[model samples]
Target chain A: MSDTPAGGGAGTRRRGRPPRTESADTRDRILVAAREEFSEHGYEKTSVRGIAKAAGVDSALVHHYFGTKEQIFEAAIAVAFAPTLNAPAAIADGPLDGVGERLTRFIFGIWENPTTRKPLLAIVRSAVNNETAAAVFRRLVAAQLLRRLAEQLGHPDGELRAELAAAQLVGCAMLRYVIKLEPLASADLEQIVARIAPVVQGHLTGP
Target chain B: MSDTPAGGGAGTRRRGRPPRTESADTRDRILVAAREEFSEHGYEKTSVRGIAKAAGVDSALVHHYFGTKEQIFEAAIAVAFAPTLNAPAAIADGPLDGVGERLTRFIFGIWENPTTRKPLLAIVRSAVNNETAAAVFRRLVAAQLLRRLAEQLGHPDGELRAELAAAQLVGCAMLRYVIKLEPLASADLEQIVARIAPVVQGHLTGP
Candidate 1:
């Protein structure tokens, strides 16, 4: 493998160093530990050392895998939100007219599955509680998810449109899944889709 | 004024005890203390003694005024959200067809003002982080704001419709004000209303 930098600079020294197997297994182990530590202690309380301890790895290894607590939180979010990364594809594959229902259904489907919902609640709760965590969440949702969704929109205000639609769905998730507000929380899934799908479509394709 | 108990009952005894001027001034001071305590120490770390100390009152006085920590949080939220209590009136006083724009504009108007929005941020942050705080926040929003708005809608699903609309605005607040996400956060007020008011209307009156 070429550890050779095309042009030698400050970056070259780090690149020239041998990879210490920031391998998939090692990364996953660290991320799982990070998630557990975050869940048990919250963002303010969780530490890199604590996460390393949980992962049964040295503190240096944790830092090597992820640079900071915020970065680690971002990494954990990326994994938890992995299924949603497929969402833009779903929109692109569908007929433009049907994008609304498809996108709405797709998002709700992720939350309907308990496996996805729990971690989402954790990250969302973190985002609400801490600015550093919110910044990571904001960057990930924008860079990874919403930007693609915006591109699929194909409008002058595509970015705005995507965010508007996101605000709608995010609100639903907060009330239904997180806060569990009555009536909306207890409402049938179909009932929500029937009402909300058009709004999603409108935000995507409407004024 | 007569502290008269017409009937000898458990509730009557409490009613017969003269009002200690749970008067506006005393009540306001206790709530200010509560908000300050919750803001400084957060929900878990804050205590009745802390609030009472901060208010320069006895713990018993704090109990007499608000009953418990959760109750104090509720009272604080109620005070913070007082401006919005007038909101149902905004929907009621306006023409039925224009309810969406008026309602959206009115809600945003409250948030637009820093005076009202700061305490709102405090209470909402508390709600997201603490279940006990969340419960108080939920109960007040439901009872004070949404219920009245639901009545104005006059639909079979008026309660559901009201909740759905609340979710929409709440999500925007989370993203725009709380998370401060791009585009949506920077988007002009009218732009939001133009896009969101119709969606809000659709929730209220649409099929």
Candidate 2:
């Protein structure tokens, strides 16, 4: 709560205290507003003031919760991609064969979900347009997530193979969701899985 | 050139009309400028005036050469992707087995060249950010180019297969060029060709 400090400290307290949950609630609201603003206007145009207005908070509170715009944008990407960020761990470690299917199912399933799709789309669109957003996106996706998957394979060229696999899915997302290219855009999910899964499997385990 | 276009009627021209090649050169310069502006500022923020300024021409000339910003954007896409737009013909009426190799070689070959890479990057980036740009990009890539490749394959789910193949390549382009992700970006073109050609071949000719 804004009014209460974890420990009694000078310049940390106010007369009235709000619940800890209330502070989290405010943070969530600001994050939601930030996502919307970033998605719509992208990184360059979005400002803390605009997000604060949208969240019905003072600009100072946005800075308090998230130190800077870059920090806020990073937080937004983390939240949006949180569903898939843990995906490398989702694949059961064993035979290398079906990693592709599990990976595709998890990644595409998140995109297919209406609730997650909205924020993911915003983050993607923002990343594509803004260099700062793209840098953060690249680090999360390439450095953190896919590279981890590559390491799990324990194969030579694991990183390259992992990236190629990622490329296929990212490309699929770019078309099916972002650009909404036809056929792929309208293709049945099972059909997509059937068609693409082997190719992914090949990338992961192929010589 | 600027003087000649203003009040010329019935073949009456100004004192030293630029050569036909000069006119073509001017048009090419404008296209280059449009690509840069669109890529940098995106479709919504990029203006004909900005493009003209970048090209060192009057805004009126941009309108004259390419009526609207949309038309200019379309022209930019055409110029940028021209190498790959006709790629189905480049593969010849060969066995489906190597069609993937030929296609990959042709598609990635364009990106490898510094000349074409600039505009292609612009179009790809703009498409990722702007809906209108994406629509135009989708039509050019899907309807004009890729769908035709699918038709040539004459396989059941030919379009789907074609798009899957495209997704592989497009995804590679996104990572290697646009996002510049890790080893893929710096990987030898031949190495990329060796690695991805089979996956593309699989998507195209695989049962």
Candidate 3:
């Protein structure tokens, strides 16, 4: 299983047009390698060389794809956190008053999406185990998600309340996805959002 | 720093008939060691031997102290979580229907105590990074803390609501302690709890 191909043989059987430099593919390969390395060995322990080796690509290719390890990590984080970050916008772009309903629906919708949730779990796991990774997680969550939410609220303590709301949301995620707490683990996403959204909305919009 | 005396020479200067083998103290030391180890390395990487080494005792002594790594971890968790676990009881035991205020005061008070907060932060950080640690965290938080709060509420969804409130409180702790977000990083405890507790109480006992 360790020797299993990382990306499946689909890459090997390319027949049409030789794929125009394969930069995007190589970048993705490096990202997958970085995620595995960071998850398994932690951020401090995972190196560019290690990621390159895992990706089965040359070190120069890895560097070419990402300027530095920090860049690679930033990319990994962007991918991992894109769902949550994208949520506020999705909710905001919709009807305004039901922001609570929309936000809750969007947030839980991401958690219910396996493709998004699995990477989130991995990112959360990595953050817990590694300081650098935790820092990355913090930066992404705070800057991209929380700050925007705070800005949207425009209350005097908007930032703090936004963070508090984030804490509640993320904690729910931790319990539901990571811990797999009973009833909650199997609970319907719509039900959860409906139940929890008002509370989150209260934090975001209440006095 | 690594070579510095374990407890700043306090370990060597202890006198008085070898101190009555206070199992609590020994158990406490072992738990503290386990907390640090688990925080730094997560559950899988944190070994009994490593904790023992950090605690300046033999690996056998660790077993004698706590029987097994899991037991040691449980002890550590109990210690780390004692504040939150005990808070519901404290609040319930207090006078009258100010349960929300009492609970909020108790919860914030624990976060303010450095002795408690440090280990709790470690546990939270560990839970984020490791599945077993996360499970242990969930079990303890839900069984010991949230259940008590839920039972006290006696509402239909009291249990779920308690869990939600617990998540909010813990999430606040995560941001204040682990993520160290600004303003919140320096917010007054009384102000925060006062503002947030009513919301929690609403979750606990509302229409």
Instruction: Give DockQ for candidates 1 onward, in order.
Output: 0.58, 0.60, 0.46
Question: Can you write out model 3's per-residue Cα lDDT over B37-150, one digit (the tens) per residue?
Answer: 876676677899999999877899899878877777878888778767887778888653577778777877877888877777677766666667767776787788777777
Q: lDDT score of model 3?
A: 0.74
Give the range of the ten consecutive residues with the poorest summed lDDT in model 3 chain A.
Answer: A1-10
Distance from true position, residue A79, model 1, in Å? 1.0
CAPRI-style grade of the A/B interface in model 3: acceptable
Give one digit per residue, the lDDT tens place, for model 1 in A1-207: 222434354553445554333365578789999987786666787899999999989999989879988889888888887888889987788688899899889999999999888777788878877889889888988877888899877898888898889889999988887777888888999999988888889999975
Report the lDDT tens digits of candidate 1 across residue range B40-72. 666777899999898888999989978978888
lDDT of 2: 0.85
TM-score of chain B of each: 0.84, 0.82, 0.81
lDDT of 3 by residue, A1-207 (tens): 111233445455455523333566677778888877876666667799999999999989888878888778878768777778887688778555577677777877888898877777777666655567667777888788878888887787888887766777877887777767655777777767866788778777877
User: What TM-score fits each model?
Assistant: 0.86, 0.86, 0.84
Off by over 4 Å in 2: A1-19, A93-95, B1-18, B21-29, B55-61, B93-95
> What would the per-residue lDDT of candidate 2 be over residues A1-207, giving only the tens digit for each residue?
343335555466544544345688799889989988987788889999999999999999999999899899998778888988888888755566889899889889999998888888877777766678878888888887888898899987999998898889989988999888988999999999998888888888887
DockQ of 1: 0.58
Better of 2 and 3 by DockQ: 2
Rank candidates, DockQ, best first. 2, 1, 3
